[model samples]
Target: RFMCDYDEAGSIGKRYRRQDEIGTPYCVTFDFDSAEDGCVTVRDRDSMQQERVPMDQLADYIAARIQF
Candidate 1:
């Protein structure tokens, strides 16, 4: 659902900012226990609110947030 071009020095925070500037929406990080947790930190680029939501419920969550 997304794509990126990497810069060697790019930090995760900086990368998120770049995606925000480009009008992209969500980001998912795959850590060791991401699947087990069944939730991930989702950031609202416009509001910068990082919310932890269940992975199995991600589609529903994002669908609820979709603007008009």
Candidate 2:
């Protein structure tokens, strides 16, 4: 099981950049709005592509990318 420990001192954008520097393949942000909408933006590190997908199905979406 994986858990996210938020860096309270860092902004979300900075967190994303840090993850990129560490070669993280993708980033998933859970915002207040996400719970209601069931969607969040997915950021691709290498290509810098961003897409919006459902939070309900995010795990499978991310797992698919990790296999590549």
Candidate 3:
């Protein structure tokens, strides 16, 4: 599953921790950089690693990386 998290402070680490404690698989963060470039930050629940994803290829990237 995928969802957008627009919490206060734009703290990806904090959000990841909260979601991790609750067992969320993934969280997508849309920041100011996205407005500048068509991309977003995707955090891996288990690894806590983030990577930039172009908006145009986001769907494909997720489909290829996440298996449900």
Model 1 residue pairs with clashes: 38-55
TM-score of each: 0.71, 0.74, 0.74
Predicted structure 1: lDDT: 0.71
Clash pairs detected, candidate 2: none
- Model 2, 1-68: lDDT tens per residue? 23444443588789888888877777777778788888998889888888889977888888777753
Model 1 scores a TM of 0.71
Over 1-68, each residue of candidate 3 has an lDDT whose tens digit, in order, gives 46654556536677777878887766777889899998988888888788999988888887898777
lDDT (tens digit, per residue) of candidate 1 on 1-68: 32434433467788788778887677655445677887777778778888888888877887788775
Better of 1 and 2 by lDDT: 2
TM-score winner, 1 or 2: 2
Best by lDDT: 3
Rank order by TM-score, top first? 2, 3, 1
Model 1, residue 62: C-alpha shift (Å): 0.3
Q: Model 3, 33: alpha-carbon shift in Å?
A: 0.8
- At residue 14, candidate 1 shows an lDDT of 85
